[model samples]
Target: MPSLELKAPSLELKVPPVAVMLLVALMMWLVSLITPVIALTFFVRLFIGAMFAVAGIAVALAGVISFMQAHTTVNPTTPNSASNLVDSGIYRFTRNPMYLGLLSMLLGWAVFLASPLALTGTVVFILYMNRFQIKPEEKALLNVFGEAFLQYQAKVRRWL
Candidate 1:
């Protein structure tokens, strides 16, 4: 019988997700300059964008608080430093609330920019994080937490 082997992702966790988000935001700005703006009122855009940003901040903070309460490392770059498996609080719903929060912020930025092209940054961020950040983190967490991590993974969606 032949064994199935998974090739390691080349960029796995090499770039910090926060940095990627910033770069994507810059790119989004450039793209927005070259694209037509969406037809949205200024007040409408401001309100919608602010709502998303606030929600993102809240969600990300919840994840951080959960990790802090659990005495686990919140640093995504060093998943091995995590001392505990946190599946409670916000973690019970989404496996990567931090990343989802960042995504929400990007969405809010896109809406504020009112450029359809700016939305592409959100998509790019998701792809990059999934490949380079989240997947690697999941592997490390599984290794650290064993079946417990697997069970948590099964119960929670990666990003909601």
Candidate 2:
């Protein structure tokens, strides 16, 4: 009998976080316009969305600032480019503060659109990020930072 062969799995569709969020945003807009399953009033939706958007932007920007201050790379595609194990500021709360922020923004969009179905787009974003973006990044971080990375992982939640 011949032995079976298998191929190694690789990251498919290497997309930037911002690009993915943009895609989700586009989906939210299209779904809201076309479907509009939720019937939330304009003022209510706007207020909720605006608050969430502001908070998300703040958190994401804080992560960016922390990276810049640490002088580490923030490019998600190449986690190996990261120079330090950032464990301060917004990073102290969540290991993937930036990704969390993006998720929040997606949630805000979902609320603004007032479409229950559009919320799936947010879940899709998280699922994609977890499998493709964060997992691979963790691998690279473990390789680079070793125990420190592991410690950070232990202390900080992946997404808070």
Candidate 3:
């Protein structure tokens, strides 16, 4: 009988996170064009749009906070590229604040466009981020930061 050796799968993939985000945004724009739903009154739409804007702003602020905390370059796709591992402020809350910020911005665009299809794109974006961006980044962080990364993971949610 031949003995089989089990090997772990490769951690990295070639897909760019920015490309994924752009694709989601494009899909949302397409949906807005097709469905063309004016579901809310102007005032209500404005309010919802404002709320989404606030979300985007908050997400951006989180990203800024993360960047400042790390005092390093901001590049999510390359976790090893980071000079420091930030576990403070917004980093304390979510491991991927930049992605969260981008997601919020996308959601804001959808709400401002007033398209249900755009909202659907937000769901797809979240799913993709979880599978591709966040997972890989976490693995890289674990390898880079070791137990410190694990401890941070235990405390901070992936996204909040």
Segments of candidate 1 deviating more than 4 angstroms:
1-10
TM-score of each: 0.92, 0.90, 0.79
lDDT of 1 by residue, 9-81 (tens): 6577778778998999899989999989999999999999989989988999999999999998988889988
Model 3 Cα lDDT, one tens digit per residue, 35-73: 977677777777777787687678767776778676876
> What C-alpha lDDT, on a 0 to 100 scale, does residue 93 get in candidate 1?
92
Badly placed stretches (over 4 Å) of model 3 are: 1-19
- The lDDT of model 1 is 0.90
Cα distance off (Å), candidate 2, residue 156 = 0.9
Which pairs, if any, clash in model 1?
none
Best first by TM-score, ranked: 1, 2, 3
lDDT of 2 by residue, 13-123 (tens): 378888999998898788777784677789999999988998899999999999999999988888888898899899889999899999988999988888888998998
Which has the greatest lDDT? 1
* Each prediction's whole-model lDDT (CA): 0.90, 0.87, 0.76
Full ranking by lDDT: 1, 2, 3
